[model samples]
Target chain A: MAKRTGQVRAITLKQVAEAAGVHASTVSRALNPATRSMVVPEVVDRVLAAANALGYRPNLLAAGLRTGRSHLIGALVPDIANTVFSPILSGASDRLASDGYSIVVADVGTNPARHLELANQLVARRIDGFILATVSRDDPVVDFCLDQHLPAVLVNRAEERRRISAVVSDDALGMQLAVDHLVELGHARIGHLAGPETISTGFLRRKGFYDALEVHGLPAGDYPCEAAAAYNREEGAKAARRLLDAAPGITAIVAANDLLALGAYDVAAERGLSVPGDLSIVGHNDMPLVDMVAPPLTTVRISHREIGRAAADLLLQQLTGGESSTRNVVLAPALIVRGSTAPPRAQSRLRNQQRGAG
Target chain B: MAKRTGQVRAITLKQVAEAAGVHASTVSRALNPATRSMVVPEVVDRVLAAANALGYRPNLLAAGLRTGRSHLIGALVPDIANTVFSPILSGASDRLASDGYSIVVADVGTNPARHLELANQLVARRIDGFILATVSRDDPVVDFCLDQHLPAVLVNRAEERRRISAVVSDDALGMQLAVDHLVELGHARIGHLAGPETISTGFLRRKGFYDALEVHGLPAGDYPCEAAAAYNREEGAKAARRLLDAAPGITAIVAANDLLALGAYDVAAERGLSVPGDLSIVGHNDMPLVDMVAPPLTTVRISHREIGRAAADLLLQQLTGGESSTRNVVLAPALIVRGSTAPPRAQSRLRNQQRGAG
Candidate 1:
């Protein structure tokens, strides 16, 4: 049983050897990647010629039939077209493809709350395990997969109770980068447009922002934090407006995603306030659309692709009979300064001038 | 002989009947979409409830095994982001999914021109047939599949030799609509930006334009045509420039696709010309991104979803042993008038002034 995306059945070495009238061991030696040296050169040539003629496909299922050895790991993304998932999926797919592994991708839109269904599919087909990007902290899918002793890894999410393998970008480092960049430009009052608390990334990222604010010794009341129900354009804009209205003294904003940052831009344009002049803004994810959206948002650029690749690697390791040793690999985030961030407005300069005169 | 993606084994009607504690015939009636209602109401409920409880997966392969009617088909698309194929794919998926048949989709970018490899995969797994959206006019994959006797259907492409089932949009009606629209707008000199000749669409659409022009009693020289290498933005711009440069008197252009029309936008912008004021453009494929671009395009909209549904129906008929007859379904296209098209840039007014002065 050779399981690939297309419908090609695999031919076993035993079948190939029998068809070629060669000893199984001789056929094995001829086909082995490492040991074809001891066989007679002419015999090896003849065996290969016959094998090719017979269309003897490599029996992947028979080779990796055991648990922790199936060599197939899955990656579940919420959406394929949102651009943020594109590089991540491509990276994981490319890395795994070279290792003779295939990613069985299922989009959440096509299969809603797909973990249980996908898990059932993978388990029935003897797929080694999975790399889930769309995991909730208290997800039933995570609990079920872990309960079965299935080798699995989480991407972009860290399970609170289930200590499985994970590859996440340092959102704390990202927040620090955002805050430090703003401080360097002499902005005092800052606000954060946080994402939904249901997901781990959103919860942890918001916590990181508050922690950073405390570390900077800024007045907590001065910097308001508005929690959005989701990390999307409309939610971001709604959060940004509320954050701005609540914290009237705020000079900069830290958005949860690029889409959020764009939403903030809309709010600013509505109020007739210029970005970086009236407000300094920063966004995360740095999706492809943000670069073309006028001001080119200042943001923390994380390697979403590297995160996906690392997740696949961890899942593959687990699939290859490795012990269920819990591990979390965190990639660092880099601050990319575009046109969205700068010094606080001239109103602050006038206040400073008044203070100097006094 | 288990099929139905990601499933374990084929569940039988006996199992469903035994679990439901009902007659096998009753279970069969409940499962069959056509006769499902004929079963006793309580018996049907019991069978369905029991089947869901037991996860009674119908092995599409096992069902097809005895009857040789596996309702599995592979769909190949060149690009996913291209709006032209999105509706078609979605439509096919919907139509196939309703009949307990699931489509195995392969985005060609992941494995370009590896249709042989894909075909072999499908063949190994017992794919009954295929619906290919990316078939070229003279494709090798077509020849290979024909030789192997794999049931196949083409969408948007008609084989020049006409050996396979195909579903195409009426390019002649579309061309006539564009030509008549331009002529009614008082434009005597018009041109066409034709798509690649290698594709059946490109060839037929260009031919349709010639046929429509002759029927409309327009001189051949009055409407020149430039062939585009592909249905893309850059190609449209290049083709537009060539048409404009060759026939300076031409005021209206009929573009092969929306992306090409966008390219014409770039050309008009470069030449400091306003759309509808200096030049009139008509696009095709009314894709998602086209409406988002500055000036919404005027084009003929083809029903991609309908084409996909029709192809699925045709393939399903063959798989179910219903017929061996070849099918050719040509759907009609509708003309949309948006912001991009207008009376040909006051050419008649300018011409009238010239005559009056003389």
Candidate 2:
């Protein structure tokens, strides 16, 4: 008679082995696909049939203990809801899935005080590796990962001098794309709405603005700049207003990101100034729905998906090789020209007047 | 010499007991904070000191095996990048965190063919409960959960007859709000852009629209309605164009979601029609940045965060009680009036003519 234990208690290997007329150790070897080849084909078939009849389930915890690897990865994002991080997360997740790894994501939210604590919790759960998207220039979590000899990769941002492995967009090139586009439109005076200086993207993009202006033979001092406290719409609006007030003569505004440029639009509306007619605006990170906004955003498009895939690949390489290598991958950024940017009004007027004079 | 072996091998309770001059069982009781009161103070101090010196870490897996619970919850989202899902996710995550439970989120993406496979994988990892944000009117996952007797709760959408517990917004009330606001503005001939009918939101909102029109003594057949295959900008634009072409007399359009309303804005621009002057538009789910878009979307605001919290709370209740209850919670929706909605041009014309005649 078949013992009907139901599913209250999971069917154990002993039960399956007994039903198969084999030892428990033999059943274990037969159940494992890697070791099944060593077992007789007839014995393996008997073990599988008995296991299926008994509804035997292998415990992942026991497998993990034997292998010393959980095949699980953790991804820590500052805000999971933030539109910028989701694409990167999906890209990384898909890449990791292809390598037979599952990800557990932790949303750190706005307060990063719990970053190290959360990482430690995942470590305690025996997560094999981590992909950190919530990195500052100097982060305690990065130090912890290094000290613990854990496989980790930084995505979207890197520490100072590329001290760790990271996959990030070329922020300087992104800024240059915005600057050169505005410069080509014949704008002599352009204002920069910089992002928070504590992060890599903010710092590099701000520096790139100056370098791009210098490359075009324009005086950096003529371009007014204001640093936003965060990469948000509210912060962008405040920084944009400050820049607008500081340099009223500036014909075009180059924002550090699309949200900041959207803030520039609000300031433009408040001052009763028309876009391209009185001022032109340029943004970075051509995120979703940017094209649908009022005048549509003209910005630098960063391939965040590619960055995510590269970050995952780097982490997997470190995990498989059993050595941490510091390799920084920089992705290219392209300018997506849209309705938000046009030739400066003063330049257009000067050209029209010159035509009249001619 | 003190054994300086690092985190490679986890220190067991037997070692701690040997160092503390106590039995392994005594060390176990002393280590557990809940049972520490039963142990003598001196023995507890010795066990703690020995544990600290040996760098002992509790094995959650072993503890879970003994307790028959894993304290881990799985959250399955349709598209993690979808803005609508983020707030709900954060809400559920935060609520779960309060109960000392951690979540592993899986982004199933658009193709839900692998939903059951992912759930089964999580089951193998011993996830205690699930908060499903992806549920159709007749879902196979819900049936599986019932058959397996797993603790599960649905969020954002529900199945027919409320057979399973769910936390959802009042779709009918949301539609009523959009319909009433437009009717109050004297829009006699309104158009509807419906969402895909497979989901509950799409079906319920469409039904609500007709019911609200009937309540307002308006003819449902008089209002032209077009269904969008998906709630996206491109689909919204197509549906809006179809409605516009089908019923040129329709003075206003009410979209099922904010993204769809954004598409309406595009179609309006394409036709060289000015918003609020030529036509009024209303949307649902006042999502992030809807206020900043062009003429600002006037829509129904559903508290997705509250729904997420409620779903988590319900799942936690079931987990702690070890029984599933069929309790469906429907949150209320409110109307947010913005720049997008106004009196119909025909109504404005009639008023102006009346004033001129008077």
Candidate 3:
């Protein structure tokens, strides 16, 4: 084989050893998390500190080729246009690239019937592993990966069975954040605009909303709930329109995703209702540019990039660490209060009326 | 070598021959564009039509391996979250995947120095070709591809010398659409929020703006212009602030891209000016959710998906047909009028004052 010499010469094990005043083999053992305890703790810490200071990254390509592995990973995203996946992909790709692996990306558009077929194609091509962002609640792709003993990690969404390793944002916690924010603003009759139930995000966030409302002493049955066919502004608007028409007294709406929340804004416009005045809206997944929308949406911000990095780490572990544990890392979600959420109109109206009478 | 049978059975030459009622050899000759003229046009047309109708995708992987190719392509996107490149990538990937090729993606972040280094890494891994969306006006990657005799295509950007095959929007025409729309709205004093000068889109779009002004019989230098350091909302807001500060009399602003136009919206909000009431704004690249923003943006719409498809076609031709024409396919752009643009506030104010006097 021709010499693979196109990449820049990365810092080597010998350099790290020289910096740490140790033998190269000793440095390697200390750097390996599993074998670090074999060496003295002080030497391991010194080696790790030296490696970090010098930006030493292990070259996994040469080592994997001997085992007939390509040292390449495949990432499957449902829709490339969906803003939520880009940050996750970026995070994952960046993490994997640092470890000398390149990601082959595939986007399975709305009709997910082709998901398994494409996964099989990539698997047949000898991809070392996969990081899937397109897994449905019960996915054939997941089942195929299990049957083949393929190393894969699910990101953003996970299967109900939990048969594979996954790194996902706390969907239940994200919805809880959205609901608590609206409830604190005195919105008792808040509606939930859920996403499609086939995806884990939609199912878990919907359940989370009801659970959160019950925790706050608000009856879940009092609030209207509607599910969007997809996570887009058009479907979101359609769902929002139906929910508002059905529950004329609902003062606020909690959207399962940012796109659906944008749809709610359109519905509010069509009805000539002012945002945060007549209708308060809280969106999940603080996607890029949502803060720049008309009312500057209040949203639950999930660390999508962190989730991507964590998923990449898990997949790398499965591939190189000889560790078979199926780990699920859940990142926390925070509430970002922008210009979209506020006190319900009824409360503000009563306060205004009292001031006028005074 | 082991017989590679990982790919599913695609439509065979026998199927096309059966559909076209021709000999297998004749069908093969007709399918190869270079050898099609050997067979009569009547038979060639029939075979081509049958191939299209039956969704007959050629198994390029099997043929490519004979020449020691991996049947893989590399796509380099500058920023994954930009929204502009997703459609392009989807188009390219869909086109390539149909031909039995997979795309390996890499994101070159703000620092572009590592572009060639990473490109070399993919090349060392034996990527058959590349579709680069991160090329600057004088990029080293272009020179590298030229030196190595590699198959590559540029999308949404081009080199200053046009040394490689590129699929770009008609930047000059897009600017013409924006400027003419504003000119027809009776705006004599229009400002421009330009993108970074280093990128081809920024450089060409800025030139297009001035050329468009000249065509509309408007003085170019009479209008204020500020260039953003990047194609992002924050830089756009900063540039918009400077332009507004420099020319308080300007009634309309033309942003080079949607993000910049969004920044102008921020400036308007800060100045207590209503869109189309105090200032009219026009943006290029009508990205998703721009229409959902307050005073939905009136902008130039580039067919990004079509551009992607065209780039893929060009790359495929170079790879299979052994053709190396340095073609630059420029697609036409359309102007989408929304609530963001209207007659200048000065004109509207004069009309209102006339009605009052009468």
Overall lDDT per candidate, in order of appearance? 0.72, 0.81, 0.82
Cα distance off (Å), candidate 3, residue B51: 25
Candidate No. with top DockQ? 2
Tens-place lDDT digits, model 2, residues A184-285: 888889989998888767888889999989899997579689999998888998998899788877889888888998888887777666776667888888
For candidate 1, lDDT tens digit of each residue in B248-334? Answer: 777778887777777777787666666776678888876643442445678888888888899888877766664656778889998
Could you estimate the TM-score for every candidate?
0.70, 0.91, 0.81
lDDT of 2 by residue, B250-358 (tens): 7788898899888999888777677877789999998888887788889999887788899989988888765455798899989999999998775553444345456
Docking class of 2: acceptable
- What is candidate 2's CA lDDT for residue B86? 74
Error of 3 at B284 (Å): 1.1
- Superposing every Cα of model 1 onto the true structure, what RMSD results? 8.5
Q: Chain B TM per candidate, please? A: 0.82, 0.89, 0.80
Candidate 2 i-RMS (Å)? 3.4
Q: What value does the interface RMSD of model 3 take?
A: 7.2
Measured over the true interface residues after superposition, the C-alpha RMSD of each candidate is 7.2, 3.4, 7.2
> What fraction of the reference interface contacts is present in each model, in order?
0.00, 0.32, 0.37
**CA displacement after TM-score superposition, residue B169 of candidate 2 (Å):** 0.8
Q: Specify the highest-lDDT model's number.
A: 3
